[model samples]
Target: MARQTSFIKLEGTIGDVTFYKGANGSFARQKGGVSRDKILNSPAFQRTRENLAEFARAAAAAQLLKGAFREITLRAKDLRTHNRLYAMAMSIIKSDLVSDRGMRQFNLGDMSLIEGFQFNINAGWNTTVYARYTIQNGASDITADFEDFVPAVKVSRPTGATHFRFFFSAAAINAEANTVESTYVASPEVEITSQVTSGFSFSIPKLVIPDTTQVYAMGIEYLQEVNGNLYDLNNKVHNSSKIFLVEQV
Candidate 1:
C-alpha cells in the first residue's frame, strides 16, 4: 500500500460559537477583532448622534413658538376689550335726549356748557368723572355714570356792586332739592355779600347732576344786587348743563 496522508481541521471559538477551517485551509473565523476606535468613528454611529441632536433642536423650537402665540392672543383680546369700552361711552353720549314718552327732544349741545370733558385724576374727590359699563351674555347691559361737580361759579360784574345773588332754573321740575339743606334749589345757586371794586365775580363749583326722571330742559338762573340789602329780585337764566351718558356692551 502506498503512504496515506490526512489533514486535521483546526477550530476557533468566540462567545460560545466554534469556527472551523474550510477545505481551502482558510480559517472560518474573521482575521482580526473589531477595534473600539474604528466603531466610534463609523458613519452609522455618527448618523445616529446627528439624528438625536436634530430631534432635540426641533423640540426646543416648538416650545418657543407655542409661547409666542399664547402671548399674542392675550394682547389682542385686551385691545378688543379696550376699544369696545370706548365705543359704548361715545354712543351713550351721542344718543338723542328724549323724554320717557319720546315726544320732547333735548339737544346734547345745548345741555352741555363745558366743552372737552375728560377724566382729570385717578381717584378721590378731585378725580375726574369716568363712566363704566358692563355687559353679560343675553342680559341687559348696565352703565355707571360719573361727573365732576363745580359747586360754585365766579361771574364778573360790569359795574361795582355791593351785594350779589344767584338763582338757577330748569324747564321742568327736574331740579333736585339740596340733600344737605332740604331746600328747593337748582344747581349752582349762590348768594354773596362782598362788594365789587374792580370786577365782581362769584366762585362756583362744578355741578354733578344725577340721572333723574323730571329733567326735560336744564337751565341756570342768574341774579345780581347793588347798594344795600333793600332790593331783592329773582330771575331765571337758562344755561347749558353737561350730562355724560355711558353704556355697557
Candidate 2:
C-alpha cells in the first residue's frame, strides 16, 4: 500500500483591508480603521477572499504537483519560472479586489488620498504587491457592481512562455455616485501599465467616478496558462477571477 504525501501546505494572508494608520498608528474600523479579520469576515469580503485564497493556493499547488516531472530539479531557470508564476498569482489577487462585488459595501478612501499602490517583485522568487488608499470618509454609502467594470490588464512574457488572463462580473459597479461629487479632488485621466517585461496597469476612464460621491470597487478575473492545460491536478486552472469594492471620499 502506498502512503499519501503532501509536498507543501498553503497558508497566508491574501487581501487585507486596513484603515490609514495615523502618526500614532491607530485609525478606525467599521467607519475608518478596521482589522483585517473584520474585513475578512464580512459576507461580501469573505466571498472574494475565500475565492481568491483558494485560487492562490491552488495555483501554488498546481506548480508543484501538476508538472510532468516528478523529481524536478530546482534550477535557476526553474526558480525564475516559479517567480513569474507567483507574480501572475499576485496580479490575479489584486485584480480580484477591484472586481469583487462584495467589496462594494466597504468604503475605500479617495484615490488621490492614496499616495500610490506599490508592487514589489523580489529576487527569491517571492513577490509582494499592495495598494494604499487614503480613507477620507469614515465609511461609504455606495456599493460596487463587480460585474460591470472590466479589468484592463496587459501581460508581456519575457524569458519564456507564460499563460495569464482574467474577467469580471457585471455586479462590480459604482454605487454611490452622489457622494464622490462633493468630496475629493479629481485628477486628469491617468493611465498605468507595466514595463515591456511582463506587467501592465491602466485605469478605466468610465469607471473613474468623482472621488467624493462614488467609491471605486474593482474586480479582476485572472487566468494563467503555461501549457495547453489551464489548471492543475486539483482540476483547477488559473482562469477567470474577480475583485469588487466601494471606495470612500
Candidate 3:
C-alpha cells in the first residue's frame, strides 16, 4: 500500500512550526501544537470518542433489528416499521448510554425486555364506551380476559358496536380518521359482536421474539354498524381516537 501521511519524529515546537524527521528519511517542518498522544488522551476528545462508539453500537443494533424482524409483515417491504421499532427498542435498552462524566444507571441492555413486559391500555383509549379486559401471562400465550359486566356488557359500550379487532406494531398505532389509510397493519380476525357484547377474550399466541422483529405496541379497534354500514370509531366524528393501544412490551 502507498504511504498516507509521512511518519515523522517531531522535535520541539518553534513558534507555529516544529522540526521533524520523516519516516521516509526526510526532514520536515509544519504547524504544530499538542502531541498526538496528548490530544488523543485529552478530555475534550473523550466525548467525541464515546459518541463514535455509541454510533457504532446503534448501527449494529439497527442491523440486528432488521435481521430479527425480517419476517415481520409490514405494509411494504422497505417500510419504516422496523426502523421505528428499532428506535423504540433502543430507547429501552440503550437509553442509559452515557459519556465519561455521565452517571451510570442500570437499563435494559438488549432485546430481552421484549420477551415480557406490562401491557396497559392507553390513557386516551380509556373512554366511556370500552370493554375491559384483564391480562394474564400463561405458559403458552398472553391471554386478555373479558367477562360479562354489570351493565350486561361493558360499562360504556360504543353504541351500535358490531365488531372488535386487534392490531400490533413496534410503533404507536394509528387508524384512518375517516377513510382507510394504507399506513398500518391489522390483525386478520375481526370478531362479530351484537352491538353489545357478552364479553370476549383473546389469547395472543406467543413465539420466540427475535431482537430484530420484536413487537411493542398493540391497538384494539371497534367498529359500529350504522345505517347498514360499518363505520370505524376514528371517523373524525368519534374524536378520531378509535384505536385503543396496549403497550405490548
Q: Please name the candidate that would achieve the greatest lDDT relative to the true structure.
A: 3
- lDDT per residue for candidate 1 within 53-123, as digits (tens), equals 43443343233322322322221222232333233223322343543222222222122321222111111
Tell me the lDDT of model 2 at 17: 27
Q: After the best TM-score superposition of candidate 1, give how far the Cα of residue 179 lies from its true spot, in angstroms.
A: 25
Ordered list by TM-score, greatest first: 3, 2, 1
Worst 10 residues of 1 by lDDT: 174-183
lDDT (0-100) at residue 97 of candidate 1?
A: 59
List residue ranges in candidate 2 displaced over 4 A.
Answer: 1-33, 44-47, 66-72, 75-79, 87-249
* Ranking according to lDDT, highest score first: 3, 2, 1
Evaluated against the true structure, the overall lDDT of model 3 is 0.42
In the range 1-249, model 2's lDDT, one tens digit per residue, is 112133532233234423343444434333346568876777757676765665654365325321311111111123244454444434433444454442321223222221111111221111211222222222323222112211223322222223322221111122233122222111122122342222223233223334332223222212334445443212122111112333432
Clash totals for all candidate models: 18, 61, 5
What's every prediction's RMSD, in angstroms? 32.4, 21.4, 15.4
Cα lDDT of candidate 1 equals 0.28
Q: Against the true structure, whose TM-score is highest? A: 3
Name the weakest run of 10 consecutive residues (lDDT summed) in model 3. 173-182
RMSD of 3: 15.4
